[model samples]
Target: MIELSEVMLEMKDIIKDFPGVRALDHVNLKAYKGEVLALVGENGAGKSTLMKVLSGVHPASTHEGEIYIKGERKKFANTKEAESAGVAIIHQELNLIPGMSVAENIFLDRQYTNGPSINWGKLYNETEKVLARLNIYDIEPTDLIKDLTVGKQQMIEIAKALSLNAEILVLDEPTSALTDSEVDELFRVINELKEQGVCMVFISHKMEEIEQIADRVAVLRDGKSIGDITKIEDITLDGIITRMVGDEVDEMFPKEKFERGEKTLEVRDLEVDHPLREGEKKVKGVSFEAYKGEILGIAGLMGSGRTELVSGIFGAYPDDTHGEVYIRGDKVEINSPEEAVEHGIGLIPEDRKEIGLLLTRNVVDNVSAASLSKFSTMGVMNEQEERKNTREYVDQLSIKTPSIDANVATLSGGNQQKVVIGKWLTTDPDILILDEPTRGIDVGAKVEIHRLMNKLVEQGVTVIMISSELPEVLGMSDRVLVMCEGEAVATLDRAEATKEKVMEYASGNF
Candidate 1:
C-alpha cells in the first residue's frame, strides 16, 4: 500500500443546488499523491455533480465551494481554466472525433505549427510521447479512431488528457464498456501514472473494480458524504454498501426459487448475419429455452453473441435473421419487432438512450409507446388511459419521477430504466428478455430490478436475462447458458453452475 503522505487535491464545504434539487450539500473530498481514490455512490448521489463542480462544468462562481491544489486555493471559471490548473476529467461518453486520426484528435483545436503551416511530423511525434507515457506502443498515432476497438479508443481518451499535461486525472466509469483484458490494461496504465505521482479519482458503480484498483474509498448518499475516506483495506464490501445506501444490504441478489414449469419460449438454430461485414455472423447456430416461473440467464464475455442471440429472436435485427422462434411450444414467424410483440415476446434493449427511450418525450408517452393501441380505438387516442396506466407502473416499479408527465430524460439512470420495463409490462408479455438491464445502474437500482425480475417470474411471465457481470448471472439465474464467439457452448442448471465452470465454458475451454 502506498503511504498517503502528500495531499494533492481537496474540496471543502462544497454546496451545489439547482432550481428544485440540492445536488451536493457541503460535501468534502481529498486525494493524495500517487494513489487511486474511489468515489462511489448510488445514482444521483452527487458523484457526477461533485465531479462537475471540480472540473468547472459548473463554474466555481455558481457553486459554493473552495478547491485547493496542493494547499493553494484555486477557483476555475471554466473547463479550460481547470485544465490550466492541472485538472482533467474523462467522461464515460468519450470526447473524441471518431473519423479523425489519433494524432489529429489528441492535438485538435490547437495544432503544432512550423511558421504559418501545420507541422505534421512534430504533431505525430508529440502524440507518440503521450502514448508512451501510458506504455502504449502497438497503436500508432496515425491510426484512424474508427478502426480501433472500444478499449483502444478509451486509451486514446487518456492519452489526450495526458497530452494536456494534466496532473490530477478524473476517470468516470472508464471500464463500463471494456473487455476483461482491456480493463487489465487500463489498470496497468493507472498504476504507471500513480508511480509518477499523478493524483487520480475513479468514479464507478462496480465494487469489484474499486477493490482491485483503489487505495481509498469514499461513499456518497443523498448529496452528502456518508463518512470519511477510508482505506480500501480497512473497509469490507458490506461496509461500503452500508455507507452508500445508509443501511445494511442483507442479500443483494434476493433470488427466489420457483419450481420448473412449462416452456414459454424456445429458439432453434438461431442465426443472425453481421450488420456490416458480409458472410460473417454475429450469432451462429444459437439455441435457448425460457420457462415460466424461472429466470434463464445468458452469460458470456464481450462479443460472445449473447446480445445478438436475443436481438435476433426478438426480430430487432431482422435482416438475414434465420431462426425458428416458438412461443408456448408453437412455432411462429417473426419478421419485425411488432410481430415479435404481437407474438407475446417483449424485449428491453441494451442501448437505453438510442433504442429503448424517447428522451424528448415524457414518461407517460414512453410507457405507452409500444401499447398505444390498447389505449386507443378507431384511430382516436385515450390520453387519460395512458396517464392512468403510466401512474400504475411508476408506482409498481418505484420509479422516482416528479410526475408521470415529467420528461423521461429528467429521471436518473435507474428510474429511466424502470420506465422502459414499465413500457413492456403494459403489453402483458408472456415472455420478457432483458439485455444488460442492470448495466450502468447503481447497486440499489440493480437490487430493485432483480427483485422485480423475481416478481415477474412468480407471476408466471418467463424472464430471460443477459448480463456481463458474472456475479449477477450466478446470483440470479435459475439456469445459465454460456456462449463463446457466436456459439452456444453449454447450458448448466443453477445447482451445477460455478464461476469457474461458467468461465471455462464461456472462454471455449470445453
Candidate 2:
C-alpha cells in the first residue's frame, strides 16, 4: 500500500493548447510512492494530452505546468530527459520490433559496448536478470518478439521501464489487446510492482478494470479536472461515470430486436493459410452463415483465428484461402477484395490505421475510397458526388469532426472507427464484417456504435462482428460462433451463450 503523506510525483496547474483549442486546462494530479492512480475520462477529454505533458512528449516548455518529483521542481526538454528523471510511458500502441530479439528491444539504444563491439554475454546476462526480477522465466533474452503473445510483450515493456529505473510508470490502455488470462497475469505483475514501491498512473476506459485495480480515481472532462481525486472505496462506478461524462449513462449496450430475413451469406469448409508461415493455417475449415436483419457475433481469445475467418470470406488472402461462398443460395467466386465488393460484401478490417484508413487523406477521400467506381465515370473523377456522400454518412454516423475535408487521423478512435464503417456502408454491402469494432474507444462511443449496429440490422444488412469483449458479443449478437485454434468449435444462440460457455469453447475445452 502507498502512503498518502509521501508524494512521488505531482503535476500542478497544467495547461496545454493547440492552434484553436485548449487541449488541457489547469489539470492537477498526484501519485504516491506505491499506488495505481487511474485517470478516467471520455473520448477527447484530455486524458492523453495530460499524460503526454508529463512524459515530455509535449515538453515542459510547450505546456504550462509545474512538475515535481520527490519535491524537486523539474522541467523536461524531451522524452529522454523525462526518462532520466525516472518517468516512463508505455503508449497504447506497442513499440517493440517484431523481428528483433527480446533483449535487444529491452536495451534498445542503450547497450553495453566495449571499444567497437557489443558484449553479447553482458547483454544477455542483464536481460536475464531483469526478466527474472519480474518473475518471468518462460521467455529467453534471445527469443524473437514475434514469438511472444501480446500479454508477454506487455511484460517486456514493463521490464524495459524497470531497467531504466523508472519510479513513475504510465500505462495507457495496457489491457486493450489482452485476453482474460493475460489481464490476470498483468494484474499479478502490477501487484508485484506495487510492493516494490513503484508509482503507476493507469489510463483506461473500462470501468470494471478501474474498480479492480485503482487505489484512487481522478476524472477529466472537457479539458479540466472535474473534482478532487476520490479514493476507490469512496467512489461508485456510476458516480465516476457521471463525473467523466457530466451526465447519467442509462444504457451502455443499446441493442434492439430485429426480424431475421433470408440467409445473406453462407460459407462451407473455409480455410485461410498463414500469410508468412508457409505450411501453417491461420483459419481452418470454418463454416457459418450470416442472416439478413441479424447480428452474428464471433467470439474468441486473441490468436483464435476469428479475424482470419472473416478476412478469408472477404478475400484478404486469395492465394492461400479456399472456401465455397454462397450469396443468397447461389455459389459465388470472390478471389479478391474487388470481387467480394462486387458481390455486395464489405469488411472493416481489424487495424484501422494499417488496413482501413488513409491517415494522410481527408474524410471524403477515405469514405469514397472503396466505392470510387460509383462516383467516377469512364476514368474521370467526380469530386462533388464524393463530397456529398461523405457529408451524408458523416451526419448519419455522427462522426465528430470539424469538416468533411479534415484528415481522418485527426479524429478520435471512436470517430475513426465510424469513418471506416461509413466507408464500408458506401459500398452498399449486403453483408458487413466488423472486427474488434470498439477495441480502444470509450463507453459513450461504444454505445453509439452498438446503436448503429442495431440500426444496420434493422435495415436488413447482415452484420458479422468479431469481438474479444464477451459482454458485447452476448448483448449484441443474435447468434455467436466460438472459435478455437483456427476452427469454429460451437455455435450458440443468445439465450444459450454465457461468458463461461464462450470461454470454454474458445479455450478448446468443448
Candidate 3:
C-alpha cells in the first residue's frame, strides 16, 4: 500500500521516439520523498531516455508524458527550467571543469555575489559546510577539480546539486568509478539525503548496490515499462533481471574454456614514464605474456598503472616510455598508435567518454574511425564504401540503433561500448587489449561482451583484459596477472586465481 500523494515526482504514460526507434513507449515511474527508486533495464531499454525526459533534456513536446512534481503538473522546456523546479541530474560521465577549483564548480553560473562582485569568502565557507555535511574533510575549497580523484569529483557533483537546492536528484551509474570504501561513503550520504526527504532516482547495474540502497524498483525492457513498480523485498536478482531482459539470464558471465596456444604478445622490462610528472614512472619493469586463444586478465587497484602498461604496449603512451614488446616472437618498435595498429595491436581505452567515441558523430563514423583508410579514395572519404563497412559491423556487433546515422550520444552505455569494440575490430588486430570494457554497462551487455570475447578467441584473436571487477577477471580469464604499485606482482592460472589470491597479490600481500 503506497500513497501517491506522498510522491515527489510522477511520470505517467511517457512516449519518446527518435527517427526510426521508439526510445520509450508508455513508461510510468514514480519517486516518493525520502526514498531511492532504482531504475533497472537492459541496454537500449529506455531508462536513460526516461530520465532525460524528467530532467528536461528531452522537453515535454519531444516526449509524450505528464510530469507531476509534488502533485502539480508542470512542463520544462530545458534543463534550466528543470533546475528551477528543484531537479538536478548527474550523468554517468561527470560534468566538471578541470581547471576550476572545487568551490567554483559547485557554485558555477550562480556564484554568491554582492553588487556585481563574486563573494569568494561566502563561497568557500558554503563549500566547506557542504563537504562537512558529506563527512569529507580532505578536499579543500581551492583544490582544482582535475587534482581530485574520481570519487571526490563525484562528491563535488553531489555538492553542486545540493547547492542548486535540488529536491529530486537523478544519478546515472554513480558508483561505476568508486572503490569499495568510497561506495560505502556514498551510500551513507545517500541515506542522509533520504532522511532529509530528497527523492532520488538511482540507476545502476550492480545488484548488491540496488539491494542496499533502493526502496522500490522499476524495470524497463526494449523501450517500454515491463510491469508495475515493486519493492526490493518482493524480487530476487534473477527476477529483476528477467523483467529487464525479458528472459532468464542463467549465467552473467558465459565464459568458455579454450586451450592456450603459442605466446602471441610478450612484454619484458616495460617502463612507462608519467606523462605529466617529470622523472616519475607510471609503470616500472612490468613483464607478462598473453597467449593466443586465451584471455589474460590484468587485476589491480585503481591507479596501479595497469592501463599505462597496456597503453604502452599499444603505443598510446608517449615516446619517452621505455618498453620491450614482442609480437609472435619478433620485437617491434611501436612509437605511435598507428605503428601498433600496423603491428596487429588494438587497445580499448579505460575512459571511454574521453578516448573511445566521437559523441557528436554517428554510430557509422565511430565504428569506421579506426579503419577509414579502407573507405578513403585519394584522401577523400567514399561515402558508399564507408556505409557498406559500417553496415557490416552494425550487423556483426548487433548494435541497436535507429540507423547508423543516429548520434552515438543517443545510445545507452552498453551499446556505446559495443561501438567501441566494433571500431577496434575494424582494425583486424591479432592482439586486442580491453581496459574496463564492461565498466559502466548493464549486466546483460556485460555478458554479451564476454561472449564476444570468447568468440574472438575462437577466431584466434589474443585478448588481454584489465578489470577492477574481481568476479569478471576470475570468470573470464584463463590466467590473471596481478599488478600492485606499477609492477606485476604475481601471475596465477585460472584454477589458482581465487578472489583472495588475486586481492592478496593486487594489494601487495606477497
Q: How many residue pairs clash in each candidate?
A: 0, 0, 0
Among these predictions, the greatest TM-score belongs to 1
Residue-level lDDT tens digits of model 1 in 345-376:
89999988899999999999999999989999
Which scores higher on TM-score, 1 or 2?
1
Q: What lDDT does the true structure give each of the candidates?
A: 0.92, 0.91, 0.89
lDDT of 3 at 14: 93
Better of 1 and 3 by TM-score: 1
Residues 1-510, model 3: lDDT tens digits: 333348899999999999777888888988899889999888678888888899899988888889999888989999999998999998878999999999999998878999899999999999999888777898999999999888889999998998888999999999998987788878998988887788999999988789899988999988888888999889988899888877799888788888889999999999999889999889989988999999999999988889989888878775867878899999989988999999999999888778999999999899889898878888999988788877888888788877999999988888899999999999999999999999888888888899999999999999999998889999999999999989999999999999999988888888
Which residue segments of model 1 deviate by more than 4 Å?
none
Tens-place lDDT digits, model 2, residues 290-337: 899889999988899988888888887788888799999999988889
Task: For model 2, give the 10-residue run with minimal summed lDDT.
Answer: 1-10
Task: Output the number of the lDDT-best candidate.
Answer: 1
Task: Give the TM-score ranking, best first.
Answer: 1, 2, 3
